[model samples]
Target: MMELQKASNGIFHDAAVEGGIPPEEEKFLQHKDDGSKRPEFTDFEGKTSFGMSVFNLSNAIMGSGILGLSYAMSNTGIVLFLILLTCIACLSCYSIHLLLRSAGVIGIRAYEQLGLRAFGQPGKILAAIVITLHNIGAMSSYLFIVKYELPLVIQAFLGLTSASEDWFMNGNYLIIIVTICIILPLATMKHLGYLGYTSGFSLSCMVFFLSAVIYKKFNISCPLETYGNHSVSTVTSDDTCTPKYFTVNQETAYTIPILAFAFVCHPEVLPIYTELRNPTKRRMQNIGNVSILGMFTMYFFTAIFGYLTFFGYTEAELLHTYSKVNPLDKLILCVRLAVLVAVTLTVPVVLFPIRRALLQLLFPGKSFHWVRHIAIAVCLLFAVNLLVIFVPNIRDIFGISGATTAPTLIFILPGLFYIRIVPKTQEPMSSRPKIQAACFSALGFIFMIMSLTFIGIDWMSGEMRSLGGH
Candidate 1:
């Protein structure tokens, strides 16, 4: 054991040297602040301010997932949607609190590290796999937005007639160019601390999107025209314009998973917590509250206005509902551009956690290495771009990813870690923490099963439709 520890320290020293860890700080990278030999805290320090950390985290939570939320609302109706959204938001905040509390008790700053302290090697690997898969799904969603929306923006800007057949209008080609020119550079960054400005900008763009939805909801008369048909419209009288207050069916089960996806900043939480200046469990929890609350407000308004505007007619992607509106309308066009840019900037933020998870799993004791970092970023972005190009349905990706990974990250893991790490003396099986953990885990399991069931039913139905068409 002693010899193995020394070997791991040696690897850390070498990686730190290559990655530019200051020589004086190199010793700090070999052990914890408590003078323990744990590899978790070696060389990591918090540099992000409270406000900036909130912005980064909120950016992480808010992604292309918001676009599908109106659809989720459509399934659940206005009243149930708000109820579920509020419940999910509260549960998300509570789970994050559990994680931060566990990390505080253990003095660990990384999710995999927390897993390591909790369940040894297997736990670490599980955490890493979950983070990698979840973030990859998230990155794909962002790219999906880029792939679908960028071409429309280009066509609008160029004033291209529908008859025009320009190569530049191709979504696949545009995604490649955008990935190479924009996403690649952002994703290759070695630290999350440097992304604060971009994250803030991304949040601002989302706010613009929310504002646009509200403006159009009131300004545009209903019933809105379907895409490509100005002559025919879904007329909404004042009476019919009011949203359905409550409804439930098989579709309602799917909304839970979509709400889970909307609030999934869990993978990115630990990394941000690590970089937060004056970090403490309480401070980190505050950041989580501010971020989640801000997003909750934005999400609620966006969904309400969007659902009210089109009511029963809201599409899966809220932006698509606007297709019938004059594509050349400057305000609507600006909203699309804002959403595109928001999701574009979000790709790098989501990419950071996946890269960290990969490094923690593959090179456990190593410090940051630019070559490895850039290579991983490039490869991950390439893979996600491919999914965006080929995967025609973002909804399926969102459903599966949210169903499988979000619940684990949000509910199961946090609850499990708290149960494992909190001392038996402090938190016995009958204690509130343990009880909460048990309930949270149970809820997560149930959620996962239901979400998968709904997704399976939807998939089979889709297949039958395709066959029927053939």
Candidate 2:
């Protein structure tokens, strides 16, 4: 047990070595800090700040999910979407609360490790499998964005014809180039702390996207064709202009699932907690709060404005809806580039958790080694790029994975882990926290079954359902 703790310390020890501390001393220091502070402190004092942790976690939560949100809003209506989004956000926070509490009680920081502590090897393997699938969905989805959008951005910048068959315009080749030049370097980093700046920059791009969405709402007045002329060509009646407060349509079945997976950052949570500076359960939980709140605001505004601009005509991908106005429109082109960059940079942030889960499951006794790290990153990228390029129906992968894995990460695993890891003597089965956790786990089961049922019905009806075209 003590040896495993040392190996875990070694996994995160790359940054800690710069202080001139020997490996033995570092191991001893980790041991001292393990359970010495309080049961609340799940992590040691590292260099990552509160703001940076928020950025990393926030970046994880924000993804292709944002691109499809306005579409979700369009189907569910403004009022109903807000109600659903609020519930998902609050539930995500409570889910994080459950994880932090479970980790504090057990002093087990890795998600897989928590599973191991709870239900032995089978539990740990369950977590590892979930993370591998979930992040693979995430990383491929990001590259999927790059694969589809990079060519368009390149062509827009180069003033080339959209149908041009130039190598530079080939999305397959462009994804390869981006993977080699940009994502590979970032994903190979030893710790999540290093990606903070990239995360912040990625987030800044999304803010620009949000600003553009809001600006275009009033600027691109309805009878939406005027978006091409940049002038108000049609002054329609109030009925057409006013927002829909509530509506029910066939697409409504997929809206909640779309919004639900938007917050699937649970895999990244404990990894960030491990790298956090002076992390306590309360402090880490606060980080989750601020990040989720920021994204909630960004998601709501982006949806509301994008919906207002197009209303009922909004497409599955909001940017594509804008493309109808003018695909070559310069501002929309830049907006496409912004979304592309945001998701591209997000690929690396998603990689860390997957790498960690693989390491724990595959090389539990091995100390951190650069060869292992680089090999995993390179291999992971290669396979994901292949998946993105070769697979025409990548959304099915995301749809099935998102439907099953999102709820498991957000609700099921954390709730079950809390129940199993916390001692029955300390927190009795009938206690408030325990009762709440059991209910939470049960809710996860219900959500999973409901999502699958709706998705199955959609498929049976010959309407394929995917979360935001991922």
Candidate 3:
């Protein structure tokens, strides 16, 4: 019986094999560039450790959006926010591990490659589209942020209120920020290998911002004000009601998902894994564990502090939440200005992978130094910024960014890859579930529905508001 079982296993193993491709050579098949082409990871020069890898992950995870998370959580109440955070953090750990495990099996360096390995050509194409859409949406949101906020800084400096309304319309400032701050640094990088330092710098800015917020909240005794007309009203025996927890409802729930979406950075994990020093399964797990915990801490604090500072009075526009929080104090204002600049600088770092992935997807055979790819990326980024400046709508941005793209990239794909690739034996040890893949896919589907629904609702709301002249 043992001999029969061994023979059956042998046949199955051989059946799984393809042609004469050894396991080592099959790693290259993950790239599947027809042998005439090679991937960037083919010549990987590793310098990352578990600590540095966590730092990079944390930095990428903590981007410009951390500022807005608390405002989103404000209406939801602290308890609700904490619940969501806990759920997402645990989900993040499982999903990240699954992604890393997928990468290890196929030696794939990007999320798209992982899809290709598991699901073939169609899967690759779909993954590429999801990532591209995600990048476009995220970059557009960042552009809108710069368009709205940077002009205020300039206006304050010039002491001119007249220049404000025309800022996004002109778009030249947006162009400058996109080109000089984002495109140029990314373009000049001889290799993506050295961007870890930039990641380090970005993480430093995150720390600085958190510290500044904490200092202000502790030193100052400012209490939060009420937010929105609908803010939490309760009925009394006299038929009068008081507001509770700032009038949170389903309509105001848009910010909650958007906040979750903004905090995610799963797509960026692939590069860090490839860059790891030993690049072992153990090291990867360690990095994932520490990074998620670190980011959760960072985000939790940022949310709490932002909530404390603005309290229930926080604006729907997250940045304004900061702007209204007694910037008259020079120390606080300086910190605010510093954080803004830091986020502005870090914008380019985020742009790197998005640009690289888009370029590689379209031109798989092309080398990293291909000038045409750079030109195309630059052109597209330029056009995106232009559109963002001219047509800035927070609801539309969130619909595309958080509701549609974030869930697929973060939760859905990881879960799918785990089910597809990870063995059941390994799964039990790792503590990830086979059923989670289905659940994650379902979550992705729900997110897609939510995305479309949000888009429709936003449009309807806008029309009604136009009629009402809010």
Candidate 4:
């Protein structure tokens, strides 16, 4: 059985077949200079294990989104949030099924190519644009973390007060420095396959982060609030620690988008599938399911513990709230460093997709060039750093990207691709699969409009308050 599996999936040059051409090398098949020439699937093999694939996919799922979930939980209440979360997770898993099914019928593994195969140039362009925007948002949010936490981490390490007026204390300047010194160099590397292993390490860091949040919940007292310069704790008998089961407000609209943003791992699914040894649909689907489930547990615990720690006082970025306990505390400081390192290292990997999407958009049918690669990375970092420096809050990034980009990738594109790519002979238009695909795409549109309306209302409310104050 092992030998047969190896012969089929391993490197072969005889003919185009499953498991031979990796998604990455799909570039070779793109060369179309001669009309009579048929593209060949280059000989390639994948060595990613089921366990490593799960970790990598989960690493993709869990990101800057976790930091804001407690705030989401705060607005939506515990019960409603869990219900929403469970539904979203399941929908995301189903979305992966749609993608795999689409890719299987036609041996197109790249997301944009699936789009192209499904609906021609427009579809491919749409997929590229959505992936670009989604990844740009991801990179911006990761840098946003750098902007928010790095300065604080620096101050803590130096044992400086919040009043310290040093240039290193400024987040804007520090983000620029870090981008040049760390993120840019890493992003310029030729091959990022080695960086895949960092996913496991990054996952471990978040686990440590979860552990710390849980520890603080029990070890720290209630009514913890930061005054002008110090933390003040007042234990009162009447202070309630009860969790809210349901909540409503303008801010509640951000919850779904945030959840969507957190679960936007669909882009990584096909590439991982192409890299699996046996590469069965069920095998890859199981990997995705386990990855999403693992992340779901971690996110729920982090939000719950962080929310319980501060309750109504929970901020959009969960890590920021911790400094109130003591920015200089040894444990908190270490967690900050771990998070900072994980995100910084991740910036390069995250940047890889965005650059690839840009290549498909701008330089199609062209071979690799160092100039394009380096220019995109530099330009991306420059633009993202500006966004991090100028953006008012990370929540805005989560809300906007989740509403628009997340749904496009997670729901709309997959559904449309499945409907178009899968043959009518295999599944009629009236079949359950096709019906579900249509409904799923429609749901994405509905989610977009609903989220936008609520966010617009929230914005108007804030504007009115400002005008009234003036």
Candidate 5:
């Protein structure tokens, strides 16, 4: 290990001599504070203030999931959606708090650390695979959204016709596109610390999308029957003889997974925490509260308004509703364009960490060339698979993500690791706090099992059943 470190340092020095850090920070420059303090006090950019941290957290949680939430709500009803959203929030806070506290005490970085801390190398490998798999589904879904939507936004803005898909058919060309899209922004980023500004821009775009939808719905008519109740839309069309609306039972249960995906964002939190202005439990809690509350409001309004507008007519891609609006007001058009831009920005935020983790695993040394090539290859493979093999069903995506990976990453590993590895004194001290942590861990474990069971069963069955057709 020491010899490997010496060799890595030689390469780093040579790179530092050749080129400066991309645009953000100087490449291969070491901070004076790095070795002096603990690894927790490593060279984290001091960019995350209290408000900014919350916003970063909120943006991380509120990506492509928001687009499909109303449909999920349509499957489940208003009251149940609210109930599930609350449950998801509670479960999310539980994991964040427990994990943050564990990190504070034990200095864990990756989820693999949690597993290794509890079990051993086997545990580390298991956690890494599960989390990586979950992220793959998530990253693929985001890439598909960007690939399909971005070209339209570009055409709309530039007033050009849509381009043909001939180029993407070539694997090398597709990889080149995916690689450039991902690497341009990420390669420039010195660390995750500086992502706050990008997240802020994304948050503004999200706010615009929400406000535009609300404005569009401000004057629309609704039946007296539909006014007070939070129910799914029930409209029939000539294309489909039958109109489908959610039965309350299915709607409520369906929100369980939707909310699970919405609030499921722990992978980015730890790295962000290291950059906090003041890394304390209180600071973390404050960030969680403000950020999640903002998200709830944004998601709640979008769900209600989206359901009100499209109702039974909603498609697998909910954004398709924008094109159907008769007037297609300039304001809505601008907002749609903005949303497309924001989502394009959002996909890279998630992709960077996954790519980074893989690089660390494969190269184990600072080979930027190797890292870039791997990133390009993975993104291209993902783009091709999504375009060819996968159907854009949010339920299927959620089920696959939640069932196979979410449980292991969010609940099982955290709970088990905390209980087993982080030893607690049998002595009488702070009983209430201990009890609370134990309870939270227990609930996380239960949710983990449910996610695994539901997702696992769905994958086995291979059916996409919705309230309307199935």
Candidate 6:
């Protein structure tokens, strides 16, 4: 098996660079064109600056996945969760480094193009499939947040009772209204670079969310000591909050994959790279590093504060936890609105890569068409809305999407492409780069296997619980 794998690697390496400039010389060439015509409808050389690019990429990295961190911490506890999150962030940075380096050496901007260069048709198709799955799942998660959280925000603002049956209070009706009003218009934009302002606003909203979590951590009283005290309100029990530092169990397997999913911005990486001003490996690497570092800090604080606030009782969606704890808290309500706006703006950013992947797969060599772009965007939003309406369990979607697609895109593909494109002549098989690539690929494979196993176990347990309930 090892001999066959080695032979396969050599074949891919040889085929990947057959017509391209040599690896060492490729980086030195001023312009390494792929000989493809530029799209007439969309300008490839966008004027996105270093700071704006960081904001856009940071927005992409931090999405609905952040909402589940408290729940993830509930499983792994504070210490292990932090350690795992740090390791995943490091791996994510390294994977982006490999991608940027490979793309720079080859002068290929699009992810599908990189895949084509690395492993031919199959590689291109695989990239498209993963991008499609991952982005669709991401968009669905954003819409899921909208569908569930939006109604409560409305109710809190209006002082509507749970018994209210008004059409305006209906979650389905509200999601549809918001989708048409907000998401559709944004998703129709041609270039991602134009959405930089919206991305920045979305990121700011998330900052407010983290702030609210931190404030509530100290303000909200714990309910444990007054569990059976009829006179004490759970929301204002006056009990001191206690935070767990470390714990582990079968559920720890699930936490890693969730953290892995939280950092997945790979599909958007190449697109952002293509648009970056003064595009180069080093500049793009800096963009990725700054963005990941910012997000890493945000995720760490959000998870720590949120977990500290709720400890053992953190729900899968932190917003839901907040709503259940204190529906009338003005600050919590504002946090909900901020998150709603953030996720609503984020749908389009996530949508761009999926649309690009579809165009690359189905309309290869064709220039961007407005009709096709609008049609694809509409169809994708429609599909995502349907899933959000029907799929009540966000964690299940998060698990499946993270387990199946996140690792492949974040770790496996980038590592393999780095090894394939950089020839042994340039970076020997026993070199540091190859060793790191091997370790990265191994990590991805391990995460992939563990995620799948955990998903299967959860599914069976859920079914048994359902059967017993019946």
Best by lDDT: 2
Query: Across residues 384-460, which tens digit of lDDT does each residue of candidate 5 receive?
Result: 35543345455464454555466555665665655654445531225564556566666656766765665555567
Taking all chains together, each candidate's TM-score versus the true structure is 0.86, 0.90, 0.77, 0.82, 0.72, 0.85
Ranking by lDDT: 2, 1, 6, 4, 3, 5
Residue 389 miss distance in model 6 (angstroms): 3.2
Candidate 1 local lDDT, 1-470, one digit each (tens): 11112222222221122122233333433333342333333335666899889989999988776877787787788888889899989998999988877775655567887787678778889999989888887777667667767887888887875634677878888888989998888887766867888899989988989988988887776666544544435554565556777878766665677786678899889889877776667788999999999999999989888888877677777887776665557888898899888888888898888988888888866755779989999999888878887877655655576678877898899999989876676668999879988899889998788777776786878641100000
- Residue 121 alpha-carbon offset, candidate 4, angstroms: 0.4
RMSD of 3: 9.2
Tens-place lDDT digits, model 2, residues 211-317: 98998887775667644444433445566666888979978877877888888899999999987877777889999999999999999999999999987667778
Error (Å) of candidate 3 at residue 191 is 3.2
Worst 10 residues of 6 by lDDT: 1-10
What range of 10 consecutive residues in model 4 has the weakest lDDT sum? Answer: 1-10
Ranking by TM-score: 2, 1, 6, 4, 3, 5
Q: For each candidate, how many residue pairs have backbone atoms clashing (under 3 Å)?
A: 1, 0, 5, 0, 4, 0
- Once fitted onto the true fold, the runs of candidate 4 whose alpha carbons sit more than 4 angstroms away are 1-44, 163-167, 189-192, 225-239, 365-372, 389-402, 463-470
Q: Alpha-carbon error at 317 in model 4, in Å?
A: 2.9
Q: List runs of model 1 lying over 4 Å from the truth.
A: 1-43, 225-239, 390-399, 463-470
Q: Where does candidate 4 clash, by residue pair? A: none
Better of 2 and 4 by lDDT: 2
User: Candidate 1, after superposition: displacement of residue 60 in Å?
Assistant: 0.4
Candidate No. with top TM-score: 2
Segments in model 2 whose C-alpha atoms lie over 4 Å from true places: 1-37, 40-45, 226-239
RMSD, one per candidate, in order: 6.2, 5.4, 9.2, 7.2, 9.1, 8.4
